[model samples]
Target chain A: MEAFITYTLFAMLVATALAAVQLNRLFAVVMLSGVFSLLSAVLFVVLDAPDVAFTEAAVGAGISTVLMLGTLALTSRTEKSSSRSSAIPLLVVIVTGIVLVYGTLDMPNFGSANTPANTHIAAQFIEKTPHQIDVPNIVTAILASYRGYDTLGEVVVVFTAGIGVLLLIGRLGRRGERQKQIGRGE
Target chain B: MRHHLILRVVTKLLAAPIMLFALYVQFHGDFSPGGGFQAGVIFAVAFILFGIVFGLDKVQQVFPTWIVHRLMALGALIYGGTGVVTMLLGKAYLDYSALAHHPEHGQHYGIFAVELGVGVTVSAVMISVYYAFAGRPPRISDEEW
Candidate 1:
């Protein structure tokens, strides 16, 4: 089981790296980036970090994808392959990949129940939370109560984004009326 | 789209349940995986389905762009108002513990109210945004319900 999880994690990392190397369509690249984020979330969950995984999945996969799609809709979808960028980003990626692999040399194996992270504040939170909040779902209790301020800020940020979008696109009423006037040859 | 008999029946029949489920999810968060976000999505899904089936202009008559626009502000007021109430009760902002005889129950009640505000704002915003994108002059509905 442990070996399978490790191999799956390794495969996902390699797949993301390969996608990063191969995709040329800008939209496709953005979608693959979402895939990368989702896989990263899965990796975090495999390490029993559900809260981080939840926020990463929501922000990285959901909000970022929406923002990128909105940008793509405003611009063009094609990646400029007219001039070939054969090597620069690829070399950078390869070097970063190697550095990452080197960094992971001393890291704990995937799904190990005894890592330092699992033994520290994380363990404390998990172990002692029942006594403090009395909520069955510790993650929700923590997110809603102990760390409620962070969630409130996140909600405020979302509300602000709604306001921003309304200011930009909702103001299209006047522009829409102007366009109609032009259409009528006035 | 106008001639699809299946879609017409499905949208008409499904709209009621979707709204019901949205309400259920809003209040039933404790026993389920749903809350404000899911309820809002479900509500928007119903309206979007209606727009797809009957047409956006028809939906506009029922919901009206003006009402949805006001709902955006109204939801925010409801959410922020809770905090104001807490202040009046001699506590910090959004202190739901002051809301009830037992403060713990007040927390549950407070969460529900805020969740409802979120649901309304989200559903209104989503449907209104959809209306903005689905462009045409307008449609004349032969039947009004």
Candidate 2:
């Protein structure tokens, strides 16, 4: 039953992707992409990665859709048909897909206990989290406590990106002269 | 927009719960699936909905752009400051063990503070990005849609 559901969802996901690619209307394409994100999130849930599923639903489906729609408002609604053929890109994509599938053949089967990911450092984290951090959720413990430095770096990266965006397009509210100086081409 | 009676009414009704949920996600993250990033996005979405329905100008009155910029910086400061505090206590940077008498207590405190910082920063950045996009004069008019 689980396999059936997974396969069904995967088929729907593929269909959505193809539809998104075929559509010329940017709005419909954006909405399809949002649906794709949502379907992926459901797949993530079935795979028992609720944390990842939550993030995917909120960030991928929610915020990204809004941002893309905002962008669509700024630009043309319909995608321009390219003068060049898509054959070269299609070939590249097929090659990459084949290589990726070949590469995944060597990976351990899903939920295999003896896999390197489960056997190696994961065991230690699972064992030590209760004694050390005493957090109820292991994900939080790992992200916020065990790998604190990495999370800090991620926050810094977010901050820097925000700064970059603000500098580029934030319009500084009251500094009309500065806004003009910064090149108000848009 | 002024004629969007149903949208305005629904938005007015929905705004409070959305913010309430965002707070729940932010604070309950340690025990649940959500955390700062999800909470922040949810929080920003509430305001963005308001901006979309009520008008960008009114939403700005509630959450000014200057404050949003400051919030983006302030969250990072809060996060870094937590680490600095640990350092000041003669421990390594981000060493939560140094924050409290009991190591677990310190870890709890540190995680809470740091996650709060993340939530604040993420929400501010999301809002600012929305504002940046929405603030621009739309090249295409609403009737065109």
Leading candidate by TM-score? 2
lDDT tens digits, residue span A114-176, model 1: 998878777877886566544455555554445545645645555565666666655547877
Docking class of 1: incorrect
Interface RMSD of 2: 0.9
lDDT of 2 by residue, A126-160 (tens): 99988788888888888887888898888888888
DockQ, computed on Cα atoms, for candidate 2 = 0.79
Which candidate gets the maximum DockQ versus the true structure?
2
**Chain A: TM-score in each candidate?**
0.62, 0.92
Per-residue CA lDDT of candidate 1, range B1-145, in tens?
6778998998888999979987886677644445665567677767877886797789998898778877866666667777788789887787776777776676666666676776777677666666654543323232321
Per-model DockQ against the true two-chain complex:
0.16, 0.79
Clashing pairs in 1: none
lDDT of 1 at A129: 57
Interface RMSD of each: 5.8, 0.9
User: How far does residue A37 in candidate 2 sit from its true spot (Å)?
Assistant: 0.9
